[model samples]
Target: MSLEIAISIVMTLVIAATPILLAGLGELVAEKSGVLNLGVEGMMLVGAVAGFITASLTGFTPAGYAVAALAGLCASLLFGVLALTIGANQVATGLALTIFGTGLSSLAGAGFVGTTITRLPALFPQGLAGHPIFRIVFGYDVIVYLSVALTLAAAWFLNHTRPGLILRCVGESDASAHAIGYPVTVIRYLAVAFGGALAGLAGAYYSLAVTPMWADRITAGRGWIALALVVFSSWRPWRLLLGAYIFGAVMTLELYSKAAGFALLPPEMLAMLPYLATVVALAVIAMRPSRGRLDAPRCLGKTFRAGA
Candidate 1:
């Protein structure tokens, strides 16, 4: 690729990865709290639909994002109630939530599939827009800023703050947390909801800024890929950023290649590149032995109760 092409690719990657990073990091936080929310894909779909509809009508991408996040938070509440409070099977609830989100999104956004959104206001000054380093890294939408800030905050929360320590305690051993008078179920519930909001925001980014339109499966199982990224990152926030950006770059490259006239592969193959890479990467990681899990919370995916 030429310098300009390479730079353009990098820019697309950052934009594409913004949502995944946000969603995955949020999930990292939720799972670290011992709640396995498999409904990220569902939450994202709903967010996409919700964000698209809101922005199309209001012409305010920010407001659309807020609505999307709210929708995601509300959708996640069901998962929280089932998995955390009622102690339902986490995997099953996640799948159900996915179905629920998909159905709801399709129904709600039936009228928005081919729509378009205006470009978001640039973050940096016009002079910075063409700057090599500044434009690619710092010049992003407000939500992009939120994603980075949240990742750092999550890192600090898990390592430095008292609440962070306590949240970790709940994730590591809910019974232990309860023994120390922490509201185990309540904490997990809140974590799940926060996670949902983040995922929603990610989805909204897709509708309002990235793809800027409504399309069924626009997320294309990005939720599952993000889930794998969490595992790929071994639960670390910074690694989540790395994994997300890399994945996003790969995804954008596939599209760019097809658009640039590569005849070697089928157009469908190009579209499949990102997901195929995610699967292969995860499989390789699964086969590894010494990558030692550094950021994994102690009791991720286990159901906890007040008296159990």
Candidate 2:
């Protein structure tokens, strides 16, 4: 490939990876706090529709992002109430959230189909930002930058901060945490809410930053991929960033293949490569007895009861 083409590919990879990294970081935080939230897909869909509608109505991308984050946070809280408060199964609740998100986004976005909007403008001035080659480094909107910052912050908070240690304590042994006078449920609620917010932001980035339009199920299973990414990273923020970029490259390759009219592989099968890659990676990870199941927090997926 030409240098220009390589640059284009690299830029596209960064764009594709940002949302996954954002959502994965959020999920990583929640899981570290001993909560398994599977409704990221649903929350992302809700955020997409909510952001699109809000931006379309008000013509303000920032406001739309705020609404999207709020929408995701609310969706996550719903999961928290069911799974944490009422003691519902985390996996089942997460599945229900995804279903609800699919239906809700579709219903809300029905009127906005086929419409498009101007992309979010770049932050830097046009001189450097307009350069075809240089734009790769300076061209992206705020969300892209925010993804990197969040990744760094998550790493710092998880390893360097006192509250971070406490959060890890809760995840490691909630019963012990509770015995030590920590409010296990409250901490978990915060973690889930934070995760939902980032997931919503990721979904919003789809409408406002990536495509800038409304569509049914616009997230296209990226949320589930993000969930898998958390596991693929062994619950580490830095690894999550690396994993997101790797998956992003795979996704970009699929698009490039289609555009190049490469007829060797069927289009349908080509489309499946990213998902297939995820499954195979997960399977390989699972088969590793030392790393697969035990890498996650010990209290993950377990219902925490204060009285028990």
Candidate 3:
């Protein structure tokens, strides 16, 4: 490929990776606090529709992202209440959240179907962001840059901060943390909320940036892929970023293949490539020794109660 073509592919790959990176970061934080939320897909859909609706009505793209994050926060709080407060099965509650979110987003977004909105603008001015080569570094929207920043921030927070140490303690031994007078449940609630908000913002990226339109299930199961990404990264923030880009590269192939009219593979097969890669990568990870699994937070998915 020529330089321009390579640049274009790289740009597309970065854009494709941003949502997953955002969602994976959020999930990584949540899991670090010992909560397993499987409803990421649902939270993303809710955020996507909420963001699209807000932007459509108000003609402001940022408002959509804000509302989307709030929507996701609400959905996650519901999960927190059920799983943490009521002592419901974490796995089951997460699945229910997904179903709830999917239905709610579809219902809420029905009227907005086929509607289009202005895509998010680049963060830098045209003078800087418009240059062909420099644009490669400067042409992205705010969220693209935000994803990378969040990755660095997350890594730093988890390793360098005192609160980060506490959060890790809670994940490894909620009972011990509770014994030490830490409010385990409260910490977990915050973690879940954070995950939900990011998942929502990630969803908004789909509606506001990727397609600039609303449709049923606009995320196309990227949320699940994000969840898998958390595992694929061994719960490390930097690894999550790398994994998201790798997956992004895989997803970008479908678009490039279709554009190039590569007839060797059916369009349907091409579409399956990303998900296929996800499954294959996961299988390979599972078949390896327990090192990666060992990296998982010890108390992940366990229901916690103050006196239990």
Candidate 4:
């Protein structure tokens, strides 16, 4: 491949990875605070529809993104209430939220099935972005850059800040955190809300930035992929970024194979490549002797009661 082709492939990889990176980072924060939200896919779907609808009506992309985040937050908050406050089973609650999000997004997006919107505005000037060398770095929309920034920020916050330390404490030992005067429940709620918002924004990026159109199930299991990325990264923000790109590269290969009509593989096998890679990667990690149980948050998927 020529330099331009290589750059184009890299750029496409970045775009493909952005949503997963964003969602995985958000989920990392929530998991660090001891919450396992399986409804990220649901939140993303709602965000996709909400963002698409708002953008279509208002003719403003940012407004659609804001509304999408809000929609996701709302869906996640419901999970927080049941799992955090009511002390419901976290896994079941997350599954139910996903189901609800699927139905609700489909219903809301029905009118938008055939609709398309203008792409979100880019941050850099077209002249600069179009330059061959410059385009490699500057051609992407703002969300792509924002996803990288968020990953770095999450790594910093988790490792350097006092609040980050406290959040980790809550995840490590909620009872101990409570004994030390930190409000475990409150921290978890906030973390979950942040995760939901990110998931929503990821969804919005699909309709508003990637495809610039509305469709049912637009995310197409990316939310689940995001969840897998969290595990694949061992819950580290930087690792999550790496894992997202790796997965994205596989997805990009699938796209290229289909578009080029590569006869070496059947269409069905090409479609399964990304998912197959995910399973293989996870299995490899699981097989590592160094990957102990302690790698994950101690309280992950466990609901905490304030008084208990």
Indicate which candidate wins on lDDT: 3
- lDDT of each residue in 1-308, candidate 1, tens digit only: 77778888888888888888988987988998988899999999998899889889998777899999999999999898888778889999999999999999989988887889885777777778767766876567678778888999899888899998888899988888899899888788788888999999888888788878898878878888788788777778988888888888777777788778875567777666656765676677666787544445778778776776
lDDT per residue for candidate 2 within 171-288, as digits (tens), equals 9999999999999999999999999999999999998888889989999998988998898888889989999999898778767766777655676876676567667767877898
What lDDT tens digits, residue by residue, belong to model 3 across residues 1-308? 57787778889999999999999999999999999999999999999999999999999999999999999999999999999999899999999999999999999999999889998889999986887888889999999999999999989999999988899899999999999999999999999999999999999999999999999999989898899889878788998999899888876766776677665567787666656765776777777886455478999999998888
Cα lDDT over the full model 2:
0.89
Using Cα atoms with residue i matched to residue i, what is each candidate's TM-score against the true structure? 0.89, 0.93, 0.93, 0.94
Candidates 3 and 4 compared: the better one by lDDT is 3
Candidate achieving higher TM-score, 2 or 4: 4
Every candidate's CA RMSD: 2.7, 2.1, 2.1, 1.8
- State the TM-score for model 4: 0.94
Local distance difference test, per candidate? 0.84, 0.89, 0.91, 0.88
User: How do all the candidates rank in terms of TM-score, highest first?
Assistant: 4, 3, 2, 1
The superposed Cα distance between candidate 3 and the true structure at residue 256, in angstroms, equals 1.8
- In candidate 2, list every pair of residues with a backbone clash: none
Least well predicted 10-residue stretch by lDDT in candidate 3:
285-294
In candidate 2, position 127 carries an lDDT of 76
